[model samples]
Target: MSKPRKPKGRPISGWLILDKPLDFGSTEAVSKIKWLFKAQKAGHAGTLDPLASGMLPIALGDATKTVPYVMDGRKIYEFTVAWGEERSTDDLEGVVIRSSTERPTEEAIRALLPKYTGVISQVPPQFSAIKIDGERAYDLAREGETLEIPAREVEVFRLSLIGCTPHLAHFEIECGKGTYVRSLARDMGRDLGCFGHIASLRRTFVAPFGEEDMVSLADLVALERVGDEGERLAALDDYLIETGEALSGLPHIAISDDQAQRLKMGNPIILRGRDAPLATPEAYATARGKLVAIGEVAEGEFRPKRVFANH
Candidate 1:
């Protein structure tokens, strides 16, 4: 029988809330971070387009397990829509497909905000990452194939017009998961009969993380100047947020060392005491401030679903 292969690099774990710069791909950013930290595993919670910038939460090592929690959270974006033309990709990168001389007034734009807010149906842009018949929509778009993409429901918690000019308008939106800002621009343009496309877009927040938590790529690159490899790695490690911080929205329970051990060994622990929760759909267990496992409380027992390594 063959032995298992040993993983390479250090097993560092935590979240790195990156302030992604414009024109940089999310996957490329993850690769750069992993290499800089010399970590064994890395992944990002959400996909930010190369055209967009700001708050990209990245998980390193064991923290990758909490990515779903972050992705499901709400997000906020600030964008500019330039009137007079619509593009193939619905953004500045694409070629102009339609043009119009008319422009929507500031008052008209503000009046349209209510129609977009709350639960609404939205059609995704053609040059998007959405799958169509087992192939990426963007790939088909690049091949010059026009697709009849279906509309899906997306919740927009709030939508407001910030400022506007004869040729441009600025807006901010807070929305639920799967909301597409590009489609909003396109739909508004088509509705107002002015034709428009996204001139600029920046995501300022992804739920559970905000601007204050973001670290720039340039700042991370500067840490590489430390001469000693160990000191350099330590400097980078200082920026990582605790893995449990990602699960702040979930119910949490503190357990004893014995309980932690049993959870690590894949055993369920009985819930005791008057204050113990009788049942919960999902909850996380911690010991001395370290995450042990994420599980459910049912029938007076805490069942381990996903266990974490000792940090």
Candidate 2:
């Protein structure tokens, strides 16, 4: 039998800030966008639950190397909690296990908001992606196994009550990595004595990239359907943000071609007389405005940590 040919896409480098749609898995979204761009390699900064929607940073080619930095960036999420109901998944997607008629007053919720702020411990939802004995926690929960999800410390920069009603309340949260909006909602409901679950969730942004940079799949598909192949590709390129944008908060350093060449070969360059931006010991080095490497500076020497293959 003839060997089945492998499908290979072109090597495109950049970041695509996708405004993810509800009910679409992160993996599926990445696959669709990857196909549209015909990118050889692709990845996402973090996984957004299929039930949640908002900014999902899709990294293409060399941009994938910066996913770790993006994942560590602060995140903003605006969500709604429907009071008086508890669900197995802690979101609307699962079966409801309990309900109550009690609802927290606007004053009561506002008062409780302060308690959720700062560093706090939260137990991630059982129907989550956390691994348990080499298997996913959700897989175990789906198979009727009860799992004890430990409470871990997560930083909540700000938690504010944005709006409220008799049955539901809206909130906006700024949190560090690993915080779960569902857990916050569930805990809030419990504190109010009615029990609650996340009825709706939308991430406003994931640092560096904001709502202003987001593009929808429908819009991307429309661009792909227009004009000739080259024109379509050009249209797509217009939406792709440079990979260096992911390193926005990091320090920037301009290095000479010789330094860049040495960095590419995983060598450290001494910056004795060179003026390096010392905002942070860690910085992104560029040569002629193109990202060359991410490195650290110590004792006037720039050390290549991760070199980009964009050139």
Candidate 3:
């Protein structure tokens, strides 16, 4: 008789925040990480332009399942605006095609930033990842085709001016998902009666992950070098944050061994053990106090909307 096939090893599952380096697209960064971790399933939560860098969350293994839940969390960035130049990509990496004639004082620029805070409509740059008629807008831009990228409704929760000079301004941003900091810098220049693009950008936070948690390109390259020289890379477990760490900020309930087994059967559970039944579906912690899934109260029954973990 033929020998039975052995099951493949389970993938390492958890969220990892990388300090993205300049010139690397979000997809490229995720690809490198996928190679490094050898995780069968992996994904990134948001897109970052190659010209920008900072807090980028990469979901490895089954952790990719939780990406949607974490995506809506707040984000923070520190970006710079150059006073008199504009480019095709809305950042310095793109060829400069326009220059502004007007110059505004630092204080003048600071006063104008508030008008952009809160809910607003923004037209994305022509050279962007936004899709149009089943084709990438940037691809069309490269084809020398003109596209009227529509204004999108995005929110900027906070915009704080950190420093300023005659030709450049530094600022911090705490904004909702899809708030394009590069686009914001471009528009800010226009608001100042000048044209501008992002010269430097760094992301500091994505809800549960922060700057302190980010692994840098230099660090990853160092690991690669060590492995190339026949040294071991990090331990298999070092990269993992326990599944619960992903939802540490949210409220939770503890399930006993028996209840955990029952949850796997897809049966509805009573709210008697939970902190409170969610009025609307939202991610909630598990009976073991781990973030398990999104739960909702419907017809006096609690049902799981998304289950992020099985262990």
Candidate 4:
């Protein structure tokens, strides 16, 4: 009398695009995924504000180690900004602290959009998690000390005025990582002479993942109640572009089994065919595919800065 063994849960790897719900922080989504999959390791590609909602990429197990690649991907956001107002938190989360000097027209907003496109320097809102020293900037803001944060360079590949209302304007933005939509709205208000803040925000895409892969909180709750986490997880695969595919834009060079073995043992992969400069040494490795390790180009070899998991 022998009993057959059943597989635990699906050995989920790669990325997960959760349509993060309002009121749930990025960490909460990760927690839910951890409990649902019983994943030993998991992490989000980027953190989302509780007030905002949309595509939040969650990495499961070995996928968690691939977070760095995901984090650097370009982000797309569709957000509504309310004109003639301002908030301390930069969005609806804060109290109204100021009013606009004039009611902005659609033409005015449209005219200003071009200025924000391409590479630009913008300061992140005080109510942000950017760390200065060991403490968060938001923590300092809450403590009532004047925030003296500095401006940073961010690339706004595209900023389009999608729709407009008398008081509300919706914009679609494709920007580099570290770009804050809330700050963009705030700065727009400043440019328009009518201060404004983000009234609503929804991330439409995180580089490769789009609305098609998004999963709402209602769906997650229903799946949890039915004890049917597997089916729900299947719906998420379309959103996860896999870490390797995500980094496909970078140059690649395959290696022999012996070379891979050596690379895995912390040796350089001895890169070839790249006649150009490189970024960080750790930035080249992809989670899937032939990308086994990330390294730097030196005199003649790409020294292993970091190695992907063997399996």
- Candidate number with greatest lDDT: 1
Query: How well is each residue in 1-311 modelled by candidate 3, as lDDT tens digits?
Result: 99997534345678778889888999999888877766677789888888788878998866787787568888998988888898888888788888976777977987897789999888888888889999999999999988998899888889998988788889998998778887898888888778999989988898888777888766665676554432433553465566656665554656565655555666666666445645545435465555555566666455766665556
Instruction: Determine the backbone clash count of candidate 4.
Output: 0
lDDT of 1 by residue, 167-235 (tens): 999999999988999999999999999899999999999889888999999999998888999999999
- Listed in order, each prediction's TM-score against the native is 0.97, 0.94, 0.88, 0.81
Q: Over 4 Å off in model 4, which ranges?
A: 1-12, 225-241, 254-259, 267-291, 296-303
Rank order (by lDDT, best first): 1, 2, 4, 3
Number of the candidate with higher TM-score, 1 or 4: 1
lDDT of 4 by residue, 1-311 (tens): 87997545455566667888899999888888776656566789888999998989888755666677768989998899999888998899888888855878999999998889988888888899998788899999899866878899999999989889888998889999999899999999989999899988988788666678677666655655544556655554444455555455555555666777787889875555554345444335433354576677666676776676633
Going through the candidates in the order shown, the clash numbers are 0, 0, 7, 0
TM-score, cand. 2: 0.94
lDDT by residue (47-76, candidate 2, tens digit) is 899989999999998999999999999999
- Determine the C-alpha RMSD for candidate 4 after optimal superposition of all C-alphas: 5.6
- Candidate 4, residue 125: CA error in Å? 1.0
C-alpha lDDT (0 to 100) for residue 51 of candidate 3: 74
The model with the greater lDDT, 3 or 4, is 4
